[model samples]
Target: MADDFADVYARLRTIMLEAAPAMTINRDEAGALELRMPGIDPKTKQPGWFGTVTTKKSYVAFHLMPLYTAPDLADDISPALAKRKQGKTCFNFKNVDNVLFEELSALARRCAAT
Candidate 1:
């Protein structure tokens, strides 16, 4: 079955919104998408931690951040997730698991709080 990144992103956005109804999500200028939660202090406001599932002609890439704003988080997840494609990181699954989705939502919430 062929996979579409835009559809995947929309599903993820829906899941995130269901998890945190107050959160806002939209695509950025670079065509990358972003999510933000309400009530975040303006001074501390920052883009929510995000994951990307990019589709290439050959394969799909699942770029997840186990932690954001801290390099160690990416480092920790990278080793376990490391499989390269054209010198880039990729994930085998077409769809992410429920646990990962929940974790991503949690990370977004945490980032919004700060």
Candidate 2:
């Protein structure tokens, strides 16, 4: 089970990294991966959030903050990916879905540009 989650996390993390090459890596480890725009937010005094892939107990989470700020990005989401969404910005998964991951990769690229 843990191995499955690790594989899922790895694949999702790769999509994020490949899609958003300009973003800064906030965390990269077995349990979590985060990417952020390269600057501090005046309001929060922290880097602007871009996305994250995190391993939770039951599943992994892929979060794209741009989806929250730029609703248009959601327009590109497929129903398959939509079923995994837990919130405006977060998608949870128990296993890897290559089709969904490809869609997610495209979304991340668009998000990175915004």
lDDT of 1 at 103: 51
Per-residue lDDT, model 1, residue 23, is 51
lDDT of 1 by residue, 1-114 (tens): 145545554555554445444555544322243445444545768654344444445444444332334434334343324333122222433455565555545543443334
lDDT of each: 0.43, 0.88
Estimate the TM-score of every prediction.
0.39, 0.93
Q: Give the alpha carbon lDDT tens digit for every residue of 3-34 in model 2.
A: 77988988989999999899999888877898
Q: Which pairs clash (backbone N, Cα, C closer than 3 Å) in model 1?
A: none
Worst 10 residues of 2 by lDDT: 69-78
Q: How many pairs of residues in model 2 come into backbone collision? A: 0
Off by over 4 Å in 2: none
